[model samples]
Target: MGRNTRKRRTPLAAKALAASAALALGGGGLLWANFHASAHESHHDVAWGGNRTKASTAQVVTISCPDVGQKLTDVPARARTEVAGELAGLDRQITDAYRRLATTRDAQARDAGFVQNSILQPLQDRRAAVLDRIGLEVTRVGGTVPTGLSALATCTGSAADRTTGGGQDGGGQQQGGGQASTGGQQGGTGQQGGTGGQAGNGPAAADFVDITKVQPNVPAKPRRTRSASTGTFTTRCGVNTNKNHNTDNVIVAPGVANGAHHLHDYVGNQKINAFAGNDTFLQGGTSCQNRNDLSSYYWPVVRVQDGSQDFDQDADGGGKEGNVGRILTPVQAQIKYVGSPTGKVVAMPQFLRIITGDAKTTTNGLANANAHWSCTGFENKVQLTAQYPICPRGSKVVRTFAFQSCWDGRNTDSANHRTHVAFADAGGNCQNGFKAIPQLTMRLVYDTTPPTLRNGQVKNAYAVDGFPEQLHKPATDHDDFISITTGGLANRIAKCINRGQQCS
Candidate 1:
């Protein structure tokens, strides 16, 4: 495969202006029984359709809106760049609106209808304009615009009452299990304080659960048959000791800086950013011990909210955006490629990009959520999806990501960045004209102290970086990958897996 040097012209000034205006605003658990509702489904009645008289007391915590990018499944190839830029603009609008809300709490307290009139409505208007541009771009490229694209323009405010509780629909309590306490106040003296995590947006007390209380939920592994490919190929990408960190997302918002709205800890490929083209990736250096594997692996940085500030404290994606704390470096980052259980696996196409989890799961729902949080010693016994696990003493935090293993065998990417790859079904068989490809799994371990609850306040709480409105919830945790493996190395990996041998 050859590197694609085709570059799309993006409006850098327009994106930068949107970001500047946003700079001003700034911004678990699977306890299946304790699962919270998606942002759209969890809005408090008083904040949504109820009388405005009650708005005086209702505290707007975050913003929730339909994810326009996810709905654009049929975008034409020529229009993708323009449409993506418009999608990113939507995010900037939300960020700016959230910042306005955060800084005007006094106004909200005085005027019952302040939030609805001053913040959300303006955001909706801004988003509507962007959505119109997106539609025009699609039509210009001879692609049919997705129906109801205009309906997603309206944004809503999520009140604190609905967002703080353990279960969104359960009204601050867990059913069947013990009461899900809305844990303590923010512990750190950092910029975060007031209602939620140190940053004041999320990781509420209700967002954590004791591992001892969670039942063993790990399902039994699928049985491998005689024809199953049982081998594994491990790639030794060292922990990001080099600290190759940034706040850019090339796949989603290429040419837009701070596109992720949160810091990312990167490993594997040394050259990664919003501006990196395919040629840059092909010529980039690698952190992997095997130079042939120049694949990139990255995820949002996890931070201890203990009154600390990273380099981005006042930067757009940092404290200004409500992401504040000391970033924790993972002690171990294990990257492995394993075979399919149903049949032999094929090599992944070069430059194939895969995002393994949903960064907006809090708002978009759990249909695509794949976050796996557990303690080092108790991973097999308990895995959490919505709440952060309170690991026992001496245990470390673990995050696991299993990438999609089925490919469409055509496009290397998709309009939504997801339709090109799909997860295998319950029987481990690829469906819908997709072919089985080597499965990529990552295990990241971190050495961190468990947060303590004292006097109804949490101390040393840790959280993953996220969009300001997403509130740093564990459920929003996600990972990104791009396969830049040389043909020789990819072939070797396939050979190792087909022969049932383990190789590096």
Candidate 2:
């Protein structure tokens, strides 16, 4: 990652660097489905920011020509070769960063708090910034080069249409190249998934809608950051302020720590998965280092509690409603989703909305994380109080109903395992567009010894279902669970159903 702010591009290597720069800056790919150009308008009057003289639209066409027929036969071949070389160097740098992120999670684990907070995080930001900068530069040169190769120009229609960046297979070339260009009145917004072409004159069409700004993006982030303060303390559980249990915060009780220990079998490996730092969050905090405190990762094992009273005899006809009973813990659960019936598990879309909005260096040792939980995990099972307005109008939102699944070492075969505990909805119900679902799925599959029953007689159950176990028809199973704000509310429920009973 060398900073190339040096304005001096060796004259010979400028063109190729410019072209590659366009891809990096202009977002060369069609992923930005939001921005589109007008249809069939080829006026060639695009305002090239740096240069004033209008370049012929034909030059753009030649620039897009397949490698075999590239335009600019006139720009000395030497300059093109040099530009190509420099671009190769930049590509290598980008690839290196991705490799570090994808494979170095463990290495990052060894980093001290300051290194993780100050150095590592900034490196990630720099990578993203460089990507955007290069993309913008490439677009600038792309805009200019095509105009110079007018003879090879395959572009047609009004200027707006040309900007759309979509067209026929002229010169037998592939279509993806330029950055997204807008063709319409300056700043009017367009709805999601809609398409319209604005012409050079007449009424301008709506502006492009950015998908990144509107879709549900699930991030695997934790509620709290790790603390070097308590490198190796052994507390049973920890407690603090009751700031209304926010969806983003985590609260642990003393008994729950014992439950997690009992279920997982192994007491102290450090629940790194839950305590790791999350890039998605603006603020990171310290963890309770006192091992005796009782609020470590394993301390909060998901348990099956009773919640039968949550159901109504009329609406549910004596059947279980959304909130029936259990604390869904993340001991060994894996929640996923998908569209096609290809049998591949589809990843449920998730969004973490930070509640406090105020950035803090830490959660101050004891406080519920604040944030909104929206996803398909609880689809069909739980209900929503208000409709989620941000998503594209028709996107189907489904969720896996919440369940308390624990990760006991029953399946010693795997590093961890999970089981499901049923819960009922307190008051909400499902609506037309949205569905209720579970936020976690615990798994366990011990005994990897070579089995003689490969003949299909003995089914290979993951086997993590030890202390917490229950079964139901696919539709009636306890599907989802929600977070409570205060320890008092949770304690009240725990007392009402002392030994685990249906509240009714």
Candidate 3:
């Protein structure tokens, strides 16, 4: 199986508050390009990448475990204990293998080895053996095993033609592969990808592969999106599609590089990230829907890799031009306001400098996998493993982003630049103690067919225009802020998104 991996800006009142917050394929089968966010990636939404078919329809053979649910049948409880021990052991092996994926030396090759050696084969083999024993014991005790027990016993997928949305056959923990074999049905919005290539062994006893394993696929989840609009009127910060270089912060200043080798498309506050303080941002001009927003919103410079260099790709002349060679300009930057999820809007903490998408990635290692990527219709997306989905002919590839909206009600810049705030759920709800702030959501779009290369390659397309030594390319691509958007920004968000007003 493979693993892998939008936006807004705004203001408001009455309700103010909170906000917040990969890939790789291992092995020689596919030479996955290098495009992944780093540890900035966390254990949150794990919706994977790739096409996926639904549950299988193969008749599930049953072998229910008799009253075994009562802890341990007359059999020695050691069996359960042994299972637990095996799980711990297997987990450690996975952890160890994943650690090697991040190593700077031989990263890509390590990932492949980890996938084939550590995960793919062993997970289905060694792990399944332990589970197989459990199942064999059940029938010995006259246990009428569940139809899927044969597969579940090994924490594997069911080797059957599934019923799309019908439940799993073997009653194993869904997490243990969840019978995740994707079939040949093409998928996306209305398309359902195919099922897994059933294990070579006969159906009833084959090792059920995970949906993600057989095919680096993810089950479809609702694609959560919020567009900015009013009943009869809607506007974006009138596109300012130019490469802003002066504000590129090339002084080799603190926190920023000497000269960001990449470029960022600035929309809001005319002047920002020029190493300005909060007051400077509050005073800058804005192109927000109404031109009143003073809140500065900025991100990595989107560039068309046609060999056009704004500043030297290597300002310091280190001879290393972190240029990706042929990148494309982002079609548009959709900036909108995000408010509290619960009810009334919460106030945003001031001078918040939120950085999304890692900017320090290189072929060596991924500094952050949270550098999110997805298409127009995908709700549940993957991270890191460069599982970029190629948008169909007319569909669009979108980099949908959600900035941290929950403020600690204190400093904007944190020691690490992120912990100072949090984000809300799709429903706008925030966590405890965190005051909700009108968040910024930016959805950068690319309208062409995905290059056979991929969206990760797209990310690798251009670097953020900053200092050369800072090594802030696709990984260092991030954003900064200073709220000055007149109260109107927050009000509008509340009325439309929060209050159930369907405005796009």
TM-scores for every candidate against the unseen true structure:
0.83, 0.17, 0.46
lDDT of each: 0.69, 0.20, 0.36
Cα lDDT, model 2, residue 38? 30
The TM-score ranking, best first, is 1, 3, 2
Alpha-carbon RMSD, each predicted model: 12.4, 27.4, 19.0
Worst 10 residues of 2 by lDDT: 357-366
lDDT per residue for candidate 1 within 103-210, as digits (tens), equals: 676677668888779987887788788888989999998999878989987765655443332112111111111122222222111112224565556565445667
Runs with alpha carbons beyond 4 Å of true place in candidate 1: 1-59, 163-195
Question: What lDDT tens digits, residue by residue, belong to model 3 across residues 467-496?
Answer: 222222222344554566565654555456
Give the poorly placed runs of model 2, Cα more than 4 Å off: 1-32, 38-401, 405-496, 499-504
User: Deviation in angstroms for 175 in model 1?
Assistant: 24
Candidate 1 root-mean-square deviation in Å: 12.4
**What TM-score does model 3 achieve against the real structure?**
0.46
